[model samples]
Target chain A: MAGTDHDKPLITGGPAIILVEPQLGENIGMVARAMANFGLSELRLINPRDGWPSEKARAAASKADHVIDGAVVFDTLEEAVADLNFIYATTARERDGFKPVRGPEEASRRLRTRNDAGERTGILFGRERFGLSNEEVAMADEIVTFPVNPAFASLNIAQAVLLMSYEWMKSGFGAEQTPFAGPDVMPASKEHLNGMIGHLESALDARGYFRPAAKKPKMLDNLRAVLTRPAFTLEEIKLLRGIISSLDYFSPKTPRGSGNPERKAKVDRDRHGKSGETVKDEER
Target chain B: MAGTDHDKPLITGGPAIILVEPQLGENIGMVARAMANFGLSELRLINPRDGWPSEKARAAASKADHVIDGAVVFDTLEEAVADLNFIYATTARERDGFKPVRGPEEASRRLRTRNDAGERTGILFGRERFGLSNEEVAMADEIVTFPVNPAFASLNIAQAVLLMSYEWMKSGFGAEQTPFAGPDVMPASKEHLNGMIGHLESALDARGYFRPAAKKPKMLDNLRAVLTRPAFTLEEIKLLRGIISSLDYFSPKTPRGSGNPERKAKVDRDRHGKSGETVKDEER
Candidate 1:
């Protein structure tokens, strides 16, 4: 999980995450890792508890070295956020009600829009125990709070960062495109499905799975309905056919092609010996 | 951050968080805390690496004691998820693409829908070092992955839990209502704004701020536009009038009432002696 892909571009540049008097180096490191996870790189520290060049922070960042290495420290919060045009103060406590309150999603959207418009924006996070003071909250353009369980609303510094960073990433990049695409196999063709169904019916007929002869067609219809409902892919149909073949004829106790030698030979050829072109030709 | 409100009902039940062979008691504790922050209380463990009842986990959970106390342990992933009607496997690495894949938002929405329908659902997370194996992922109904930076895709166990829990909370409850409401101050009345503007203009006139008599109206118009644009609150207008009064005539070096005694008295009374009713009467 700590591995970093140097070959891929290290996506940087988002709202600066300004930590105002963060207490622990480990927390700071974790914050950097969270920020990096969501493509944020700018980190500004306002009077860190332990002075700059913290080994604990470096170690905790896991491989988000760029975020830590590029971190800028300021003596005061004012200086830390001096260059940013828009600022959001993150707090759990209620303030004197001068500023507008926003939830994380709205705040992230605003930040992303402003960032896109070429305005620098930042989100201010407070100390570990007590959050941003009334005065600090007043400095920001607006207030942003997470919709946490009101009773247990206090999120750890890093958890807060992870949440906001996630929203920021989602707002900017969207959540539709996963990092990697899923399997591209097509759904089973009706013809392919019918072939599998016919083969399975023959196997079941040999085993007398359709109990009463009068109920055989109804039982076959039920089996087909169950099998067709899943919309099995070509690969799945092939696997199901293999399973049926193994159950009916592949057991060592029974010789492989003892029953219906010609059909068994055809199934065997399709299963193990047919090439992609031959399979397509047979499908045609 | 560690405080919990015992008086309030503890929010229990969401998608069960199934950790498969999770290592580190601290991570388990952090995961529990994250879950508590978002109101998810169900925690199911499938063979935790170190034995259960870990003090480290309890300490790490901050005040999310209920989550830790209610955690259930199972011998296998199948046993852990036996009762759940739907399951989502969280993975940072790519799989062979058998199951459908979803981003966190989509996954959370699906889980919320299922949970609301009275179906038991769970999210599966894997070991800290390596994520859910292909086999473990295959056991779930679908795969859920974070939309993270492709270069730094890996997220530590707790961070991953925090992200998904946040999404779950947002999906169910929405992110519109912040925990606390903002200030309820109304916009200043036009009469109130004009009074402050006129008072400041008189002060400027007394000090010859409008250099030429011919341009005084234009100067007054510019000043009015600048002051009116902010749409200051009633309190803000009152504060501004006080500032104008202080700057024009309240210096200790000069007598308080020497410039304009009647106006001085009105300003002083409004600044320090008026009650809410008195202010309303004046506005009327």
Candidate 2:
């Protein structure tokens, strides 16, 4: 059911969808459908087969043309993702590299949460014929893979994206929690989320998630959105902050400890330029 | 041939066999029969109708008596798994509970990995007629469900155990390395896995995947295993990383438009767990 505030956007910020050399129009259409299923609209096609906005794809989109109609076509992968702040790649197979990998739900959660903080997030999907080149992966901040039987882990592009988007929609759309009825049974207040953002920022800052100084402004805005996106009841927010404080302040001292270094700082700096920066210049 | 090197255990770990109040000794016999076909040997009984360790059961176990002879019996599931590290409950319906769940293959990987970590792992299969109770499911750390179409997700107790056990045997028993050459490629490495994990974490972190800190740690771990289970080749991992990075990192942002904080961060926490979780819980 549409909430009392039906006019509000389901997603907090922009997330571009990049399909690197997709093998089929059906898959593109399916991906579009999945995006639409989760309220995603913008799609970037990087050398897709069967052309852009094909009838086949439109048919697959069903009611998802809102995504298809606005899809941007690009000849190169770099051009497709030039302006995004954070990017995640989805794959059924594991990619060998020295980076972080997560599940689609995890990736979607991170993307939605970060974007709620006000940064742009994008999800990358690969072609059916083969997948993305190694160079393309180096450009991404993270990877998203489905938990499947490794022997049978092959998932259609749309399914992969849809699952991720579904996760995003669940949390990003402020739908992550059950509909919290206030004292009078009304929805919770929106301002509380601002406080949640502040808490998150404090935790992140303590962990040094922010860079030296340049990314501070953009990062703070994003942090605010990410925190404020959820309509948290006092109790829920309490629980949220409780876990954060626990992890941030009372973290277990394992031999391998965690410190949130500004991992995305390198990628965030490039957000300023009107055009995008390609970290892995070598094409696969 | 078994890997003679000391690097691997001769018998990694068999799938956890769960007998949810199985009714007949003959069924247990056949269950063991099925398990042997897939090289599975672990056995567990919840509450047998005819009583466990019956001569009838011993007869059914046949040559699989090693499995039946050593089968574990429990008056209550909590007692059965008190010493185990991870427990997965199976089901088929869309019930009220269950959160983060996986299909059989993913469950197998979780079981194998936990086994590798020197933890006791087990699978739970419900009774012949009624399956597991909801309260019983509350005991498990995770839930496993089949990928059959919703209308026909149901499987017999023995069948369900067989499928899950088969996957475990595949993983723990050297992954059928020779019988299925699988394109003549090696699996992904810890280093390669780290990159994909990092990438996924950042993307999801930005998107707010790890909200409500208490659930985030477990959620992220679930996400990690899903992606990491597959044995990825170096080139393949790089390729996948490239493809996903392109979609997630690439693409231009749409112009900002009217949006509301009310709709952002819609907290429907129930969605945190996969439907499969409930299905396993309810059906089993």
Candidate 3:
């Protein structure tokens, strides 16, 4: 789970991640990892520091070998993005208003839309210390900035890559579905729920737990409200009924902690009668 | 710009960030920096490896001293989140259908809503390599997972922290506004656009650019459509008119490539006549 699974299909193809003069090979590796996590496979580097074929980056990639291995290098930023139809330059610093600046989410949507239309789009990241130059920003069609605390907006290269990659993935695949789904249990039928509630009420009535007769109706209403709110599953309703049955019949005088076996058997028979067939008949 | 600004107000009091037995001090530092970037200040660490007060973490925090300095440590994850009314456990691996699982965006919204309602909430991040155990996840009210590639779902501790922090910031501040606004030039007046189109049409007419007399109207419509699509600015319209004027009157025989000076003077005079006063009068 901590490393790559070569057997599973590697999701590829999205906007190119263009790094303009990225300083550290380790940063490049982390960027590759982030890109891999979000299914962005295209990596373009414009004059990376210490040249290409970086072992440091490969090690940092943490087994995202495909991205690091497929990374393309260029002598200039223009050459790197020459074939791209649209480009976005990422920056933390404010510039003299020229290109339209978009937050990451909007920019990701635009990039995804353009990409869907068969247009090649890329986002440019700057040098490790000083972000994209003014000339570099001008080269892009638009600017994208992270919505961060303006006072401490400096995000490391990999962190920036993670945000854009995350947003790009969310834009294309949507933000609704996670890697896995939640539990898929259905709500319990009202008949089963009312049966459980009635059983509990009867037990409470025997114990005189509803207080004075004048307030019994209000207390029942409150009890019903609480029980109805959870929308419990069929299994949960059965469990509740079992608990009520145990409380109503079991005592220290019982032969064992197993409670009255006859009552338990009756409870099991009643639960079966209330399930599947009965529920379907009720629906009909 | 790379470091913290102590003089600036530190944004605090969002959901608490609870890290369970995090292995690396550098990762903790990075998490702190990511939190600071997105205005999340409260940090709760549950038994970090290598103990607390590590110099490596401080250096990695990149001067996000406020977050690192104010970080609280707990002996257990339960104790770390003892006061929180709501909790979300982050996991990369799928679990055995129990708690409700939400994607980061939805989870962020829920966290923000609970926080706004004056209820304390926290997000639980697990160890660097092993992640949170099932027992640890079972301690939370809900499961929150990233929408990452199923084949490569592993996200470093810092990256996980960054995504949660980013979504939290976006949930509160919104994604509509970037750090700065774009250029604010007004759209060109329709009268000005019409005037420029008419001048260009006249020039083309003089050159017999619309061949075949029967197609003249269609050709004129096509010309107007292309010119009208951009919604050009006032300055852009003026530049377009100037270009057209130069094309209509200039010749290789003209001295100093200045275009016919007499015609240029007339063009200037006509442009003045089509200015603010003329536009306002026409509107009336």
**Candidate 2, CAPRI quality class derived from DockQ:** incorrect
Ten consecutive residues with minimal summed lDDT in candidate 3 chain A?
Answer: A275-284
List model 1 lDDT by residue over A1-284, tens digit each: 43456688988998999999999999999999999988999999999998887999999998789999999999988888888899999987767877889988889999999998999999999999787888888899999888788777759899889889988888886535677666664677888778777765655444334556777677667666645655677766554443333333321222222344355445444443223222221110
Q: Which residue pairs of candidate 1 clash?
A: none
**Quality of candidate 1 docking, DockQ:** 0.15
Tens digits of per-residue lDDT for model 2 on B1-284? 01122242223245567777789897787677556545566777877888867787766554555567778887877777777777888876545764568866678888888887888777777776777788877778888875432211224565566556555655654422222111344666777666655654543443344655577677666655545544555555554443223223311122123322432232122112112111011100
Q: Write model 1 residue lDDT over B1-284, tens digit each, in one string.
A: 33456577777788999899999999999999999999999999988999898899999998788899999999987678756656788987776645677888778887777677676778999999888876576556677888888788759889888888988888776453234332233345444555665565554443344545776655444444334433355665654443343333321222222354355445444433222222221210
**Which of 1 and 3 is the better model by DockQ?**
1
Q: What C-alpha lDDT does candidate 2 achieve relative to the native structure? A: 0.54
Model 2 regions lying over 4 Å from their true place:
A1-14, A173-284, B1-284
TM-score of 1: 0.74
For A234-253, candidate 3 gives per-residue lDDT tens digits of: 65555344333322332222
lDDT of 1 at B90: 90
What total of clashing residue pairs does each candidate reach? 0, 78, 0
As a whole number from 0 to 100, the lDDT of residue A84 in candidate 1 is: 89
The interface RMSD values of the models, given in order, are 35.3, 21.5, 33.2
TM-score of chain B of each: 0.60, 0.55, 0.59
Predictions' DockQ, in order? 0.15, 0.02, 0.13
